[model samples]
Target: MPDYKHFPLADTAEGLTEAEIIDWKVKPGDEVTVNQIVVEVETAKAAVELPIPWAGVVTELLVEPGQTVEVGTPILTVDVDPQGAAAVNGSGSAASAVSAETTETAEAAEADADEMKPLVGYGSKTTVAKRRARKSQATPAAPAPEPVQAVTVVAPRPASEQAAPAGYVPLAKPPVRKLAKELGIDLRTVAGSAEGGVITREDVRRAADGTAETASAAPQPVTAEYDPATRERRVPIRGVRKATANAMVGSAFTAPHVTEFLTIDVTPMMELRQKLKGAPQFSGVKLTPLVIAAKAVCLAARRTPDVNAVWDESSGEIVYKDYVHLGIAAATPRGLVVPKVRDADRKSLAELAGDIGELTAVARDGKTPPEAMLNGTFTITNVGVFGVDTGTPIINPGESAILALGAIRDMPWVVDGELAVRKVMQLSLSFDHRVIDGQQGSQFLADVGELLADPAVAITY
Candidate 1:
């Protein structure tokens, strides 16, 4: 009998534990070539195309698209050998023997295709098992997933009192939980007032205020100890999330991040934006402060080319790129992604707006290709969309700086040495100190601020 080997999920370059099958390029019964992309998997970081290492017909698809698979799971099966037709009188002709030999050769080639890489601590070479590896493949004795902690928004009752029957701990976001922990409040002791039995940040604050009652409940012993889950979410980190995570981590630690803030009176720019709204060219396009900020960054890059260069560790030099690949930080359902606009410096205002719109649309739809997410020269993150005033944005890896555009609101400002009301906004620039010094960074930021303060300055730039 010929060996029918199953193709297990391999370790993608990124160390991801599980990946969701976004799409399957090949189907059952399809003859696949070695190293051919057969499936697209989405990790938390990005979506990557998985290539088949063996050449054979796909006998069975073990998992369907949108299904998550753990690393080392057998995703599909391929039959290396097909049965030869029955011979008359139990006798085979000369041509049949030759054809069987050819089939044997093909089967042999298929078997030879998948050469298992050795696992450490094993005394001898062991081939990967034909069956899919369980979630506990690495450590078989691990326990199941832990139960979710319940949140109670009401205050702790007297020593003898107990919680309401339906008062279970509520679910809250990680950041909200962090806040509660910082305030030294137990999540379970507080009664969740948010939707769907979820704990809100406000609920935690209300508990801290000492005015809220603990939903007629006593302080119960913390019985929930989190268990080590054998169940893992293995994502083949290949796409935008993967790229963005790598970039953010690299930029955060390596870059001596020095963020400088400048609050500007943008009353004139707002007037200009309003005037441009009536123009025929600005029709149908979303005219926001982000568009102006993008143009500003482009103008600033022209003034300071060093801001748009990558630090080449291998060459021990900085590689200054002539063209600008402006990365716009977009938050999608999957994760944070920075898709670039190629030659953004050369594009007209309308063209840049159109490209930015299209890039964001594609990224949100999860249709943006892998290559478009790479090789960014600089990044712009608009925190204003989230109603944030300012943030020290991390530089995207390979780039020297990132500009954060803050919320634009009407505020009291000193105009011509007098306190007056104006449309005030802030610009926060985070730069890699290794490449950009305080003076250079300040200049670049000032140039950007100037452009935003006066839109007509872009014509000269």
Candidate 2:
């Protein structure tokens, strides 16, 4: 008899209540080692691969792909006892092996009927099984209609004497049925456009609009022909997109935002970046204007620490930190993600450039770990890459302020009492009004602008 162990979905991060199973790496009867990647699950934040903590042979998959399960729910079961498994296999009798396995399962269930075992990192709790009421098991079908007689009476039959169509059942899904009910449309009278005479939501809508043809008409061939009216595609909101939406909503409403803008000549910073590209220390590092802005923000935060602090409403206190965990906002195919560069204040220009390069690459590949996105003190969004001017940016939740960098363009400016063309850029800073006053916000933005105006000032400090 083999000892079966249940693997539950672990709590991967703070405030994560559930995760959707995206894929399974191992199936039943496959041998697995300890710490082996078993399944990939998608939380609201990102897609993470869960490792099996113990070595075993996969016995069963309790959950299916695309199903969203709550934390601490058993996702799979494994047989950990190798000797018992080998004995069952050596028996050579399939029936006997199955019987033995069944007996062992029953015995184990009886022994631990009142107790639940917790998987690593996840708490244990007894879950009540609630099977969904399937449509097949819900209402019985109506009787089939009888065939017409060769000879019929001249007199018409009464309403109660009429028979329904043969094997006729509305094939709409639950949602489609509900929609039809709400639209006051009879599903029985609507024609099904789906294969096998299945009713679809579109069919119901078309029927309601008096545009649906009868099912008895010749069925249309299912082909690749596209129609503009029905050519729309829908993508599910999950993973990074879902997380970004919730956080943005919370941040927008919770924080009292005040945005300030400043336009400055950044010709010196651009020149400095070009010069650094040839330096031996920055030979392979890719330096961009965003990197310079990030360093300037760190330097400015030293003078105004309130901009790097969090306003904790629950604790009724403002949490300030001396170290800066700078977040760089990166847009990926999945959605927008902000992965932080840890201890950014302590890194040099070359080091910061390297870190930014690697972080952005990882984020674009959709491989940013959840931990990399947490605990950001301040965020920088380079919307200038999209060839747009500066616009007010929303602050990330738990962070005090966010800085937006606009596209740098050659514009007219005054230099030594003479009009000249200079590389000018705009900066927008949105801060939490509760923690940072207007004067402090203005001074912080000014400091950042001054650094960009004269890159040599960074060395003086």
- By lDDT, the best candidate is 2
Best by TM-score: 2
lDDT of 2 by residue, 296-321 (tens): 99999998999999999999999999
- Model 2 TM-score on a 0 to 1 scale: 0.70
TM-score, candidate 1, is 0.60
Residues 335-430 of candidate 1: C-alpha lDDT, one tens digit per residue:
887789999988877777778888888878765665677788999999988989999998887888899999988899887899998888999999
Give the runs in model 2 whose Cα sits over 4 Å from its true position.
Answer: 82-231
The reply for model 1, stretches above 4 Å from the true place, is 1-20, 23-39, 43-45, 48-58, 62-246
Global Cα RMSD, each model: 18.3, 13.8
Compute the lDDT for candidate 2.
0.75
Question: Number of backbone collisions per candidate, in order?
Answer: 25, 0
